[model samples]
Target: MCDGYATHNGELAIGRNLKVAFMPWKGYNFEDAIILSERVVREDLFTSLHIAEHVVSVRETKRGSEELTADIPNISENATKDLDENGMIRVGAHAKTGDILIGKITPKGESDPTPEEKLLRAILEKAGDVKDASLKQNHLTKVL
Candidate 1:
């Protein structure tokens, strides 16, 4: 019966058998505290990978529709280095925490423009009434 059960389960191993000692170390392991060796961390023997996914959606708003574009205003060039021309992170890009994964802009409401803004708008022939709504990474991960 044991052989049949083992054969059905395919002999799955879930845990590693490590050499354990029951001695206290530096007065820290007094009450069931476990002390791990430096090799465990250096080799990453128990490290696990966690994957998190984030989605950015552009929806219509009362002011106007949100847009996804690479031309985000008031952002530094270094922040958008991983982003492609289509405002999306390139595949295989390493995204760090607080890095913009998707560049997005939302239109602002119609309000009185400042004199300097009016002059620049007239000279540039563009409406600079958009606020950045880009999606940012909350943790370090790789774009796949």
Candidate 2:
């Protein structure tokens, strides 16, 4: 009967069954309190792995369109070490907090230009109106 019930319910064992002792230690385990061994936590016996997906989208704006590139201005080389040539994170890379996952740039409106910028714009004949829009990691995680 038990076998039939388990088969019908699709139930399976999920944890280890350990031998427990009901003993009082400094009056802490007098009631329904339970104490766990340090080895259980050190070995991560109860830890579970959770997988999540994040996405980045590029769309057209009123000024210009968004672009993805690895050559983002004002960012250090160490911050973009995990990114590939396509501005995306490399597969199986270990990412930590504040790491850039994707390097993006968006166009911005033109304000008052400085003397150097005006000279460069006049020589190059191109207006610099873009700002960094990179995606950064919120927590320490591994990219898979």
TM agreement with the true structure for every prediction: 0.60, 0.61
Clashing pairs in 1: none
Model 2 per-residue lDDT tens digits across residues 1-144: 354433534676456766555666666745554567888879988787879887889998765578887878789888888888889989888889888889998878756566887688769966477789999889988888
> Alpha-carbon error at 44 in model 1, in Å?
7.3
Q: Highest lDDT: which candidate?
A: 1
- Model 2 earns a TM-score of 0.61
lDDT of 1 by residue, 21-138 (tens): 6665666756655567889879999877786677788998765578888889999999998888989999999989999999999979577567887688779977568899999988
Give candidate 2 regions above 4 Å deviation: 1-47, 111-127
Clashes of 1: 0
